[model samples]
Target: MIIVTTRQMQQMDKNTIESFGIPGRVLMENAGRGAIEMLSEHFDLEGARVAVVAGRGNNGGDGFVIGRYLMEMGVSVSFFLLSTRDRVQGDAGANMDLILDLLAEHALSQFIEIPDKDALEAVTEILLDHDLFVDAIFGTGLNADVRGIYRDVIELINDSDKAVFSVDIPSGINADTGAVCGVAIRADATATFAFAKAGHILYPGNFHTGDLEVVDIGIPGHIAKAQSPHIFLPEPHDIAGLIPARAFNAHKGSFGHLLVLAGSPGKTGAAALCANAAMRSGAGLVTLGVPEKLMPVMEPMVVEPMTTALAQTSSGGLDAAALDDIITLLADKAALALGPGMGTDSGTQELIKSILAIASVPMVIDADGLNCIAKNPDILATVKAPVILTPHPGEMARLTGKTTADIQQNRMETARNFAEKQKVILVLKGAQTLVAYPDGAVFICPTGNPGMACGGMGDVLTGMIAAFLAQDLSPESAALAGVYLHGLCGDLLAEDHAFGFSASDMVAGIPQALTTLLS
Candidate 1:
């Protein structure tokens, strides 16, 4: 599904109003009604005491509409206005007046105007008595930290422990970055109009926004299409459609051969995991190339893939001198899976440079391979083949020469900028892994869980990407499908239990994950 930023959503709303000739008031009405429909789906309203905590904005106007609907339904709704009634303007003022006119003599008990912090405290106890809350203090336009009466109101609503259904977005959450501004409302659910915002899917904000329901508020399809949203969350069919169909009469060579250069003395397990995962990911054949001395160790560890001993340094990692032999070996390989478990020895690092210069097919570079290239990222420009770099935050920091905190704070931008500059596909691996393309488009993977945080997970992912590439999927398709499948495997394991699944266990779940997609 398309995920828009705050500005993009605003533009979409504006286009709908101006270009499509849809009145802003009609849009507001649609929002209010849509929210009611969403609320009705999740909650029962008969005789319920609902509180509409509203500010003097469009969001507040939406609250007034919801309150009016509830009142008509015989559900008692109290409107606690954060601003003076006169301060509300535009479409919101129209909605507020309608509520006032409809309430008539009942306004004395149903409408309480808490115009400032002093009045806000006076009615805290009364507001807490409601069975449910509708948060409308702020919306997507809010860019700064929330303060004063609004903060107090949000905190009180959260402290009440009542189920909250927010209008547009949760109050005090940054609708663009998903960052919490000061204290924010922890809603049981949110009813956002038009499209899902970045804040709803991104962290902390995602945590604050419990169950999200995106309500269509009469925004024309052309308006949203005109905005050209570049960010998206991949669905099951997305991966399933990209997966190449297997022929009934095909042999092993019909898939493709994958040459994986990995492992060192102590990290042979990493190499074994990568190659084994590649085989599991449907690669026709996998050749594990390791340091000469570690051949005996990895050979028995991985059964399906054939193994080869490459020239090694004294430290037992592949040496730069192995370049000639590697070039010869690559002659028949469909793709190169480089980087997992190859140690950070000087010889191995130099060997990485040589391999990058000579690789002709797509390469999935990870782990020690990424670390070596962070030392000389300029090598990325020299690589002739399409390169996919899988980097966690620390590796990304090293490559960008920025702090890890900066990378995490701006994951989408950092990944997008780097991929565009280097002309490579970047898989920024994390909770919500980002697959950034050279053209500035980004795909976010929502699968996987915290249980997949253990070692060897990236190695498994590296192999999966290579396997997809071997099947002739483009770099983007391969990365998206591989990352999604990798996460799905972990999510499946997480369903049975949490936190103890190993990388090998994840590999075992690959076929099941693929089945889910195909189905």
Candidate 2:
């Protein structure tokens, strides 16, 4: 599903209204009717009292339409306009007129205009009496911090403990960035028009936007396509479509071989987990390459993956002297998974740079492999086959020289910029893991849960991507399928236990996830 920014959505809406000849009022009606349908699905509206808290904007117009429909259905409704009746203009003003006429006709419904704080206080008790609040104060255009009576009303609705349904987006969220603008309404559900905005899927806004439903508000499909949205939320079908069917008569050589360079003295578990996950993800053969000192440790830890010993530093990290051995290993290899347990010794860092500069196979770099490149990020510009860097916020921060907080705050922009500049596939791993391409397209993985916030999970993901690349999937397909599958594994585990599931447990669930996707 394509995800749009506020600006792109606005342009599409404008093009629909002006170019496609769909009137603004008709769009507002469609939005309102659709929201009512969603509201009925989520809450019992038969005997419920609904408070339609509206601003004097198009969003408020949507609220008026909802109130009018509620009254027609014989549900008790109250229209609380944040501004006086005359202040409403445009299609919203027109809807206000119609709703006012309905208010005079319906005996059970009432219209209250609270343009100031004093007027709001006068009806505070009345506002609290409703069982549900329809929040239509702010829409996708909200950028400034919310204050004054708007903040008070948002706070009141939040404190009401009543079911709150939002229109377009929750009030006080930056529709583009998902940042809370001072305060935001925590809705029970939100009915977004046309398409899901970036705010709806991004961080804090995602938390505020609960059970989101995208309502078709008469925007032409061609108009949306003309805008060329680059961001996407990959559904199950999207990931499933990327995976090729396996041949019935294929052997080990038919699938592809994967070479994984990882491991150090104390972190041999990282190497073992990554190598095991690669085999689990369907790699024909996986060779676990570790420093000579850790060969005994990793060899027994993994049963299926073949283990090899490379020259090691005194510190038990892969030494620069191992470059020739690694190059030999890369020959005829399908893909390379680098950096999971590799320590950041001076020799190990040099060895990583050497491999990165000369290796021809596609590579998925993670853990300390990413840390090694952070020291000389420009090395990414040097000779390289397709490369995918899977970096958590800390590693991403180091690569870009920004704080982790900064990276998290601007994940999409940061990932897109890095991928475009470096001409590589960049996977910014976190809550909604993003896979960004060199062409500036990005895919957001909507799987995984809080249970995935443990060690060795990224190592598992590195192996998955490497396996996919080895299986002849493009770098883009491999990254997308790997990220989605890794998250789906965690989600499967989450169905049984919330947060105690380990990375090994997720690895164990890969076959089940693949079955679920393939079936």
Candidate 3:
């Protein structure tokens, strides 16, 4: 789905009304009707009682229209106006006029305009008693924080102990940053128009917009395509098309070869997991390279994985002598999964720097591998290889010389900056994993949970990306596809003993997730 910012949506609306010749008022009526239809699809509104909290904007016009429809359909819907009917302007003013005449002719409940301070206080309990609260007090245009009476009223509705259904967007949340503006109404569901707002899919905003329903508000698809928004919420079908199917006559050699430079001594589990995950991720073959001293131990850990012994320091880390052999091996490899169990000893760092200085295949760098590059962040510039750096917040902080808090505060910016400067894709792994392209586009994953915080998670991701690269997917496609599948596996396992499960459990679910795509 196309995820747009407030500016993009407004521009689209303006162009639709002006360029496409769709009347603005016509679009408003369609948006309101579309939202009602969406709500009706999931809910039985035959007798449902609703409260529409309206402001003096187009969003308020949407609320008023929904109220009129609900009332016409034998449902009880009361409109609580933040201001008097005379203050409503433009399309909103026009819509309120129609509603006022309808209420007067039918002797229906007139919209309770907060005439004064006493009236405002009295409406608090009245709003709290409804089955649903419709938030149309604000839309994406709100740039400043809401305060005074508006803030207090928003808080009152939120504390109502009733379910909420926001129109266009929930009031007081910044559409671009997803930051709460003074106060915000936590909607149980939101019906936004045409394009899905970036805030709906982003962290705190997504959290506030429960079960978002993107209503078709008459915006043309070509105009949206023309806008060329950089952000997107990747769906399964989108990535499913990108997953290349094997040719009918395909053999093991046609699948792809993956190289894994991992393992010390005690951390052989990381190497084993990386190699095994590559095989599961559809790699034709996987070669597990370990410190020469740990080869005997690593060999026993693998059954089908090919093994290589790299020269090691006394600490069982890869020595500089290992580079020539690694280059020779990389000649036949399609991609490389680096860092997993690779130690951070000087000799290992030297070996890593050597491989990165020249390795041409796609690379997924993680763990100790990332720390090696942290010593010289600029080394990322010289490496011509297609690189994907999967870093947890601490590792990201190390690479950027910023605090973890700083990175998290503006994750999109931090990841995009690092990736652009380094000329590599960055997968900033956390609660909502952000995969940032060097070109400044960032994708926020809505999947994955706290359970994925365990060890070997990053290792699994490295292997997955390597396997995708081996199959000829571009660096951006590989990272996006890899993280989506990784989180999906976690989401599936979450259904049964998933949260209690470990990183290996997420790895185990990888094949299951592929079946959904492969089929």
Candidate 4:
């Protein structure tokens, strides 16, 4: 599904009204009707007590239209206008006028004109008694912090213990960035127009926008296509297309070999997980190159992938001297998975630097490998091989010299800037994993849940990406497919269990997730 910014959506709306000749009022009516359709499906509108908290904007017009439809359905709706009737203009004014006439002719139970904070406070108790609320006080265009009477009313509605259905988006959310503008309504569900906004999927704002339903309000397909939304939420079929077809007669050698350089004195689990995950991801021959002393530790832990000992430092971590051994191993390897469980010793960092300087195969650097390069990111520009760096927010901060908060606040831009500058595929791992390419294309993975926030997950991901690369998928395709399949596994597992599923559990789910793609 296309995830659009506020500007892109607004422009699409403009083009729909101006170029496509769809009247603005017709769109408003369609939006309100579609929202009502979704609302009716989930809620019983007949004889139910509901309040429509309306502003003077187009979003408010939607609320006004909804109020009329609810009244027609025998739903007792209280229209709480944030501004006087005369203050509402454009399409909203037209709808408000119709609602006012209908309310008087039918002698409706309520119409509270809350023009100021004092007016809103007077009706707080009355609003609390309503069974449901329709929040149309603000929409996606709101960029500044919500204040005055609107803020107090929002607080009152939240405290009411009643379910709220938001129009377009929750009030006080920045549609483009997904940042909450001071405070926002925690809606039980949101009925959006045409396409899903970025705020509906991005965090903090996503918390406020519950159960999003994108309503088709007659925005032309051509207009939306012309806008060319860059962000997307990939579906199963989309990911399935990225997976390369395996020939029936293909042999192990035909699949490709993956080399995993990981493990330390006491961190054999990370190395074992990385190499084993590669085997699961269809890499023909997976090998682990660990510190010579740690060979026995990983050799017994992982049975499928062959293990080779590398020159080690005194602490039993692979050192720069291991580069010669790694080169020898890489001769048969189609791809490399580096950095997991590799301790951050100076010698280990040197080994990472040496590998990057001359490594010919596609490589995925994760965990401590990312840390080593964060110390001297200039080495990224010097690497000749195709590179993929998977980092959580903290590692990303260290790499780009920005605070973790800054990276989180602007994930797409931060990842994009680094990928473009370093000429590497960047996978920003977190709640919503983003795969960014040097060409400015960014794919957001909507799969995965809080259950995925565990250790060894990144290591598994490192191996998965390397496996895809080994199978001859492009770096961008491999990174995107890896992140999607990884998250899909967690999402599937989440259906049966709330937590306690380990990275190993995720590894086990890989084949099932791949099957889901074909299904």
Candidate 5:
């Protein structure tokens, strides 16, 4: 499932037309038919009126094709042509002519041409008298904020009580960034072509697009794959495929071992959550290394995991002496999950820097461990391991010294840019967690709900990624699978609890969530 930018989508359409020999008109016909099928499934009208607010773009062409099909099916479709009928050129123009020709005798009674705002309002009033509204005013190619007649028409639809089905994408949404250029149509459902546009999944767009249905407009799979869009929307089967099924002869050694350095005195809960999550994520062996002083307190908390007591400072945090023991401990560990309850004490930061200096395996850095790295991020440039940094907006702001507002505003660019610069797998965790790979691909997760907003979520996510990495998943796959699993688990928990659910509860639901997916 590749998510394309507006430009990329247009390029794909152009390539199909020029290189692949698929004419633009043929594609437009298919696009229209595809959207109409989706519309027919949800809306049934033997003689009811359907209002189509059409523009001059291919999106309007799609609406024209749909309107023609509906009219052919014995449904009354009233077309409100925004621009002059003669201005519609190409396949869109042809379709508009065909619709008019079909209703030539009923032109005055069926097709309504509105060239002004007053006429548009009169058309909107007529549309309100109908049962369904088809919004084709604008599409993915819209780059600037809409105004004048078009904006008024979109507002008219929004104010209408009719069920609105947006064709392709809702008008006024920037297809690549999901930024609302101006007033965007709040559609009840959107039937998109081939794949979902990047804007369709991005924040405000996600909320506006009620129910999304991606229709296959008869594009060949190979051609679509050739587009090489750098974004992916993770699916359940995606995670299910990456998680290896255990062989009958598999043993503890078959599953990789994980080494987790976490927990301070008062923050021992973070360590417990991190280590427990690793085991729950199917790590064959997990070694929880904590300050020796907290070992007595942490030992009982983990039933299946083994605990190691390391040197502690007077502050009851991990000390530099633990570095030697950590090196010796890392010999057979397949992956390492650092941070969590690890405090930002000067000595602990030294330990983090020391661990990174020597680590050869993949590592997931989170929580205060990220805080330590933020003080001197250049250390990441020297680490030998494949590092995955999972940072929240605030942590990301500190790591890059950019305001949280900057990070949140352009999450995809911020994370991708930082990941490319730092040469690490960057997981910008927030409402829609973004996974930016070293190769420049990014995935925005769709699973999580508001329930997974409490403490220890990142710790659980850190452990999950390490578990996947230990199992031999590629860095991209591990981050993608981990984020998907983390959110899917949260979504499952959201069912039983209120919107204000806890991250700990979501952690408890991980095994159950995976079990459901596997089954």
Candidate 6:
């Protein structure tokens, strides 16, 4: 599903209103009606008292529409306008007038104007008496910190312990970054119009967004397509479609061979996990290449993957002398998984540079492999094949010469800018793993959990991506599928246990994850 930024969504709304000729009021009505439907589905509206806390904006206009509908349905409704009746202008003011007319005719509902803090305090007890709170104060345009009576109103609603439903987005949540603006309403659910915004899926905003329901507010498909949203949330069907069907008559050679260069004296487990995960992810064959000193250790640890011993440095890492042998080993390989446990010794770094200079297949670089390149990132420019860099925040920070905080603060931009500039597929692994392409398109993986935070998890991911590459999936498909599957595995384990599931456990769960995804 395409995820839009606030600006893109705004442009889409503008295009629909001005170009497609859908009036703003009609859209607002549709949004309000859809939100009411969602609320009815989630909560018991019969004999319910709903407080429609509204601002003097289009979002507030949506609240007015909802309140009018609620009154028509025989539900007790109250409108608490943050601004005075005259100050409510535009479509919002018009809708407020309609609500006023309905109330004047029937005297069924109450309309309270609390434009200042004193009025807000005067009605504080009345506000908490409602069965539900409809948050329509702010929408996707919120950027700065929320303060004044607006803050106090949000706090009251949050403390009310009543079922709160947000409109478009939760009030006081930054619709673009998902950052909390001072304080935000933790809604029981949020009804977003047209499409899910970036804030709805990203970080803290997602936490506050609750059970999100995307309401079709009459935005034309052509208008949405014209926006050309580059960010996406990968659904199960999308990832399932990427997996190639296996041939009935195929043998080991049909799937493709994966060559993994990993392992050091103490990090042999990393290589084992990578090679094992490759086999689990459907690689035809896997060859675990390690320093000569670790051969005996790796040979006994792994059963399916064949192991090759390369020349070793004094520190027991792959040596620069192993370059010729490593290149020869890549002759029949389908893809390369590099830098999992490989240390950053001088010889190993040289070996990494040498391999990149001459390798002729797709490569999934991670861990120390990424670290080696961070020392001389320009080596990525010299590569001839499709390369996927799997970097955690720290590694990404090192590669870009920025702090880890900087990378985390703006993960989307950081990933997109780096991928576009470097001309490589970049997987920024974290909470919502991002798969960024050289063309600037980014896909967010919503799978995985905190339990997968343990060591060797990324190594498993490296193997998964390399296996997909070996299966003839494009660099983009491999990265997207791999990240999604990796997270799904963790999620599957999380269903049974919250945390403490190891990377080995994740590897064991790969087939089950694939089954769950494809089935």
lDDT of 6 by residue, 1-519 (tens): 888888898898888889878888989999999998998899998788889999999999999998898999888999999989998898888899999989975555899999999998899999888999999999889999999999999988888788999999999988877889999999999999989988889898899999999999999887888776368999999999999988899888999999999999999999999999999999999999999989888998899999999998899988999998988899999999999999999999999998998998999999999999999999998999999999999999999999999998889889999999999999999999989999988888899788888999999999999999998899999999999999999999999999998999988999999999999
lDDT for each residue of candidate 3 in 1-519, tens digit (9 for 90 to 100)? 777878788889999989989988898899889888877775667556788889888989988888887777767778888888888999888888888878864443557897456778887777666777788899988878897777878888888767788898889888876778888989988899987776777678888988788888778888887775267778778878878988999888887899999988688989988888888888899999899888778888777789988888888887888888999999999999999988889888888888888999989999889999898877787798889999999999998899999987767768877877778899999977989898877888767877676888888888898889887898899899898888888888878864678767766779998997656
List the candidates' TM-scores in order: 0.96, 0.96, 0.91, 0.93, 0.93, 0.97
Query: What TM-score does model 5 achieve against the real structure?
Result: 0.93
Better of 3 and 5 by lDDT: 5
Worst 10 residues of 1 by lDDT: 102-111
CA lDDT, candidate 4, residue 147: 93
Model 6 spans > 4 angstroms off: none
lDDT of 2 by residue, 137-159 (tens): 99999999999999999999998
Evaluate candidate 6 by giving its C-alpha RMSD to the native, one decimal. Answer: 1.4
Query: How do the residues 133-248 of candidate 4 rate in per-residue lDDT, one tens digit apiece?
Result: 99999988998999998988888888877889999999988887788888889999999999898888888888999999999999877778887527788888888899878899
Candidate numbers sorted by lDDT from highest down? 6, 2, 1, 4, 5, 3
Cα lDDT tens digits for candidate 1, 59-108: 99999998888877777889999999999999999999998888875543
Scanning candidate 6 in windows of ten residues, the lowest lDDT window is: 222-231
lDDT of 6 at 214: 97
For model 1, the stretches where C-alpha displacement exceeds 4 angstroms are 105-109
Indicate the TM-score of model 2: 0.96
Q: RMSD per prediction, one decimal?
A: 1.6, 1.6, 2.5, 2.3, 2.3, 1.4
Q: Report the C-alpha displacement of residue 434, candidate 1, in angstroms.
A: 1.4
Indicate the TM-score of model 6: 0.97
